[model samples]
Target: MKRRKPRILTLYVTERCQARCSFCRIWEKGNPKDAAPAHFKALLTEARRLFGRIFVDFTGGEPLLYEPLPLLLKQAKEAGLRTSVTTNTKLYRQRAEELKGKIDYLLFSLDGTREYHDQNRGISLYDTVIDSIETARRLGEWPDLLMTVTRENIKMIPHVASIANHYKLIFQINPVFSYFGNTGLTEQDVKMMKEYIAYHKTYVNYAQLRLISRGGNSTLQPSCRAVTSQIVIDPQGRMLLPCYHHALDRLDTEGSLKKAFDSTLRRWYEKRQGTFDFCEGCTINCYFDPSFEYMRNQAALLSLSCRAKYAWLRYVERPIEEAFKNRKRGEL
Candidate 1:
C-alpha cells in the first residue's frame, strides 16, 4: 500500500486587521481583498477529493473580519472537513453563535497580562480579549488559547498560564518566530526566552501530549509528513505555500493549487538537507527543519498510536481534564 500524505489546508480569508500589534507578521491596514466564495468552494472541492481526514484552518489578520466566514465553514463541514481558526478573539462574541458546531476548535491569540498584552497588541485589547473568552465560555465554545511569547511579554508567561487555568481553557505557549518584520530581539531577549522555555517545559510537554492524544494535528512534527500530507492555500487562491511563513514570503506559485503544491514540495525536498544562512539554531515549531530530526526517527506505528491516543483523549477525557487541572490548582 502507498503511504498516505499528511494534509492540512489553511485559508487566509483576508489580509485586513484592526490591531496594530508590534510583532504581528500578517497584519496590514485596510480591508485587503480575499478569495471569492466561488474560488474557495473550488479549492475546498479539490481538497476533499485528494486527502482523507482533511483539516482546514482559517486564518487572517483576523479571519472574523470576513463576513462570510460562517458560510465558508458550513460548506467545509458539509464537505467532510474538520475545521479550525486562529483569531484574536475580538469578534468572537458576536460570531460565536454562527461558529458553533461549524468549527471544531478555535485557536484564540492571547499574549499575556493586560498591561503586557495591550503593549504587544494594542491599547485596551487585553480586556476585550478576556471578555471575548468569558463570553465563549458562557456559550460553551471551549476554545483553546494560542499564546505567543516574545521579548516584550516573556516575563508574564506564568500569568498567562494562570489566566488559561482560571478560565478552564487549554493553552499553547509558542515562542515568537524571528520573522523579517519582527522588531528583532537582542541576545539577552533570546536568552530570556530560552530560560522561559526551560522553566515551562513541563507545561509545554503536557499541552503537546494532550493535543496529540486528542487527535489534533500539528504541522510542526519534525517529520516530512507535510511533504506528503499538508497543503496550504493563500488568500489569492493561485499560490500554495508549503507552510504559513513561506506563504507570507510570497514565493513563486504555479497558478493552480495542485501544481503549486507539487512545485513547493519538490523545491522543499531538494533543499531539505541544505542549510541556509537563516537556518542557524532556530526554534520555530511550525518550521520543517526543527521537526526533521524527530520525524526521521518516528516509526509508523508510533505515529498511528499518537493519532489514536489523540482521538481517544478528545472523545473521552479532554473536558474533565481541564476541570481536574483547575481543581488541582484550587481554581474550582
Candidate 2:
C-alpha cells in the first residue's frame, strides 16, 4: 500500500452563523470561540512542514463570518498550499475583495430554487445567494454550487442543477445525513437519493450513500482517512479525532501542531482509528472523501476508479454538449 500523507486540512474557522437551516444544527450552538490567530499561524507553517503542501479548506457555520478568515487564507497561500472555502455566501459581499486571490476553490451552498432554498434555510436569503453568485461571476471567480438534498427538496435536484447549468458553472449534490442528533434521512430517502444519483452526472459519494442506507458506517468497517489524509480541526484549535461527526476526542495544539499530533492521546487514537465503536456506523464525508484515494483494498480501488471517471465527467460533460450544439448551429 502506498503511504498517504495529509493532503487536506478542514478548518472550521468559526461556529457563528445566522441562517437557521432545517437540516443542519451548526448554527444552534450559539457562538463558539474560533481558534486563535496564533493557532492558525502555527498550522499554516507547521502543517506544510509535517505534511507536504496540503489542500486547506476553511469551513464553518459560515466561514465568511470569521474575522480572521482573510488573514488565515492569505497565510495559507503564502505557505504555498492550495486553499478552499465552502461558504454559505452570507458575507461574500463584504469579504469578497479580501479573499480574492487567497482562495483557490470556493463552494457556494444552495438547497434548491428560490422558494425551496428560502424555506430550507429558514430565512429569505435566496435573493442574497443569487446576488452573491452574480457578484462572484463579476469578479471572474467560477465557484461550484452545492445543494444539500433532503427528502423534501430532493425533487428539486435537477432544478438546482439547471441553475448551475444556466450559469455555466459546476454543480454538486450531498444528501442530508444525521449530525448532532439531527436525523431526518429515512430508508425511503436513501432509496430516492440512490435513484437520483443513478441518473445525474453530478458528483456523488457512493460510499456515503451506501452507508446512509445501512443506517451509517454500521455495515462497513472504517478504512477512514479522517485524521490521516485530511485533518479536521475545531474552532478552538483542536484536531477532531477519527472524524468530526463521531469525534470521541479532541487533541489541543496550543504550542506545536506536529508535537500535539504526535502526543500520546492522538497516537492512541491513530492506532485505534476507524475501529472505535462510534466509528462503526459513521458516514462523515469530510473524513471519508479523502480516504478513498488512500484505500489499499482492491475492491475499493476499483470503486475509486469509477468515481474518478464521473468526477471528471461532471465538469466537462455538459460543456462538451453545449459546444457541439454551437458547432452545429454555425454549420447550419
RMSD, one per candidate, in order = 6.8, 3.5
Give the clash count for each candidate. 10, 3
Per-residue alpha-carbon lDDT of model 1 for 1-332, expressed as tens digits? Answer: 55445456767778878777777746664447676777787777767876756888887768999888998999899999989887887788888888888889777788888877877777557777788888887876767777776667877777776777677566666655556467434456645654654322112422222222332333343333333445555677654433555433343333345555546455564244213333333334443322332353434444455445545545546657767877889963
Q: In model 2, which range of ten residues has the least summed lDDT?
A: 193-202
In model 1, the runs with Cα more than 4 Å from the true position are 1-4, 29-31, 183-229, 241-244, 247-256, 262-282, 288-294, 298-315, 321-332
Q: Which predicted model would earn the best TM-score?
A: 2
CA shift at 107, candidate 2, in angstroms?
0.7
In candidate 1 the C-alpha lDDT for residue 320 amounts to 70
TM-score of 2: 0.86
lDDT of 1 at 202: 17
Model 1 lDDT, residue 122, Cα: 70
Could you estimate the TM-score for every candidate? Answer: 0.74, 0.86
